[model samples]
Every structure is written in C-alpha cells, then in structure tokens.
Target: MIDVLVAGGGPAGLAAAVHARLAGLTAVVVEPRTAPVDKACGEGVMPGGVASLRALGVEPAGRELRGIRYVDGVRRAEAPFRDRPGLGVRRTTLHRALHERALGLGVRIVPGKVGEVRQTRDSVTAAGITARWLIAADGLHSPVRRRLGLELPGGPRGRYGLRRHYRLAPWTDFVEVHWSGQGEAYVTPVADGLVGVAVLSRVRRGYDEHLDGFPAL
Candidate 1:
C-alpha cells in the first residue's frame, strides 16, 4: 500500500509528489511518457510561479524579463505591475529539471499509464496499485477527472487556442505579449538568442494562420 498514487507526471503531479515526500509520505507517480516530452506552452514562468519553484529547490530556467508590455488588439503598453521580472525558460528544460529533482527526492517514477482506477472506503486503487490518495495531475484532458465526474471552468466563449513552435534565439529581457484583432501572441525566451512563440485566438482557425505574417520570429 502507498500513501499516495499520483496519475500523470507534469509539473503539478511532480510538485505534489515532491511535497508529499517532504511531508513524510510514500508517493508514486504513474506516467507513460519520459522526460522532455514536447508541449505547447509559453515556456515562461511568472514571477510568483518562479517563487513557487524556489520553494521546491528548483531554479529558474532562463534569465528574467522585465519589459513586459501588453497590447490591446493593436498597440502595446506596459502592464501595471510592481515586480522585478518574469523567468523565461524552455518547456523541456523545466521538465528535465523537475524530473531530476523529483528523482533526487526519492520519488518513485513508474513508466505506466493509469489504465483504470477505483475507490473504496479510505482508499483508491489505480489499476492494480492501491493507495490512500489519488491525484489527477495529468493535463487539461485528465481521465481521472472525467472518471470522478469533476468539471473545470472553461475560458470565455469567443476564445480559442493555437500553439506552435519555431527555431529562434532567446532574446529580449521581457516577454512580449502582442494583442491583435486576429488573435493574441505570447513570446518567451528559451535560450540565449532563441525564443518560443505561442498564438492564442478567440477564433478556432488553422494553425498556419500566421506562418507568413510574423517576419521577425
């Protein structure tokens, strides 16, 4: 029997297991994929998010960016915030670091997907492994949540998302979020002279909508 059986191995799951172990509990994470799994994310951690990482003994992935400017469908303006800067990191870099940290803390990483899970009085059984608690940190489309009949709030009605990556350098001291009538663009620094740009829109259209528009990136 285990104290906790965590489904999924993303940031949330890894964080939970690490904390659980620090609090003196037997934790195990069931995940199918290994480290460095590709994802569609901004690759930048907000100031507060970075602070959370520090609590877990993890460092920021890239240099901090301060010149954050938000645009309103056309022009841009500095966001009203009283903070130093946000940390820009690559998705793979952060994932690898956290995976390593979790392993260092005596976390059991099982390379198996949670095919099934059941609950009983004071216990939960995921597949054949039983534990006192079950955590569903898989991702947006979490199977555990669906099995447990949990619902998460959705975004606005007219909002949609489209994320793709490109090969670029990690430049700029701050992430640049461009607001446009077509959609919203988020840029984060991944490495020296390399950047990761993501696109989010209120309309669900083809991903190549801006493949020819963005010249600099």
Candidate 2:
C-alpha cells in the first residue's frame, strides 16, 4: 500500500506525487493518459509558479518571458517583471519534464482510470489500489469529485479559449495581449522559432475568424 494515491496524471497530480515523495511518503499516480499530455492553455508560467517548479527540480525547456504587453493597434502598454522572469513553455514540454522528475523520485505511475472510491477510517482505495490518503486532481469535470458528491452547482457560462501555434520567430520578449472589441488574444513565444496565440472570448469562433480581426498580429 502506498501512502498517497493520486488520480489523474496532469500537472497537479504529478506535483502532488512529487510533494508526497519529498515528505518521505510512497506515492503513486493513476492516469488513463500517457505521459507528455497536451492541453489547451495559456501555457505561461508566472514568476512564482516558476519558482515552485524549480523547488520541485523541474526546469522545462522554453522561452524566457520578460513581462506583459497590451496593444489595441492604436494604444500600447508594457510592464516588465521586476524580479524573476516568467516562462512560456508548451504543455507537452512541461508535462514531460514533470513526468521525468516524478519517475526519478520513485513515484510509480499506473495506467488506469479511477472509477469508484472506497474509504475507511484509516485508508482510501481507488482503482483497486489502497493508500493512506487519496488526492483527486482529476480536473474540471472530475469523476472523483462527482463520485464523492463534492461537485458544486454549475455557474454562469464562461469564456472559451482557443490556442494555435505558429512557426515564426518571436517579435518581442514580452507576452502580447491584443485587445479587440469582441475579446482578447494572448501571444506568447514558446520557443525561439515558435509562437503560440490563444484567444479568449464569450462567443465560440474559429481561429481564423478571431485572427482576422487582429491584422497587426
């Protein structure tokens, strides 16, 4: 039996496993997906988050970000970080780095999905594995949360985010936020020759539809 069993193999789950191992506990992560998982996100690790990752001995390969820039075609504003710089890393790169670190720390990763969770006064069991504690890092629509009756009521509709990568050199070190009448577009340099653009808007639209408005991009 392990001391900690984590559901999901995403960043949170892997991080939990690493922390458990640091605390001298045997931890295992059960995830349905394989390593180097990709997800749609801004993919920007802020300064504090970068420090946290460093503390876990995870330094992913990516571009160093200076700060943020807001542009509306006419007006432009920029803010540089005062202390540590942020990182713009791809989801896959970040995942692979964390996965490697977890493995090096003796965190066992099992391949399976957690269905029903059973617990006793001293132990918790899921996916036929028993542990002293269970961590539900299953994400937004977490099955563990639902099965444990911990899910909260649905809230109002939220904005949708879409991301796409372009094979182009970065124009600036600062992350660019292009504000439009409809929504905002976040542009970050993930590598020396790659730039990721993500749009957040209330209305669901294709990448081309959103990019059409940002001619300067």
Per TM-score, the best of the predicted structures is 2
Residue 111 local lDDT, model 2: 97
Candidate 2, residue 46: Cα displacement in angstroms equals 0.4
Per residue, candidate 1 scores C-alpha lDDT tens digits across 1-217 of 9998889998889889988888899999998998866676777787887888888888846867666766554556876336656787877778888888889989999998886778899999985789999999987778788778786678224455566555665556677787655776788776676777788776667767753344344
Model 2 CA lDDT for position 23: 91
Task: Please state the error at residue 148 of candidate 1 in Å.
Answer: 0.8
**Model 2 TM:** 0.92
- lDDT score of model 1? 0.77
Candidate 1 ranges beyond 4 A from true positions: 72-74, 152-171, 202-208, 211-217
Model 2 C-alpha lDDT per residue in residues 1-217, reported as the tens digit of each score: 8899999999999999999998999999999998989866788888998999999999999999999999999899999999999999999999999999999999999999999899899999999999999999998778798899987888244788889999999999899999888889999999999999999888888988988889898
Q: Which regions of candidate 2 fall more than 4 Å away from where they truly are?
A: 153-159
The local lDDT score (0 to 100) that residue 165 gets in candidate 2 is 96
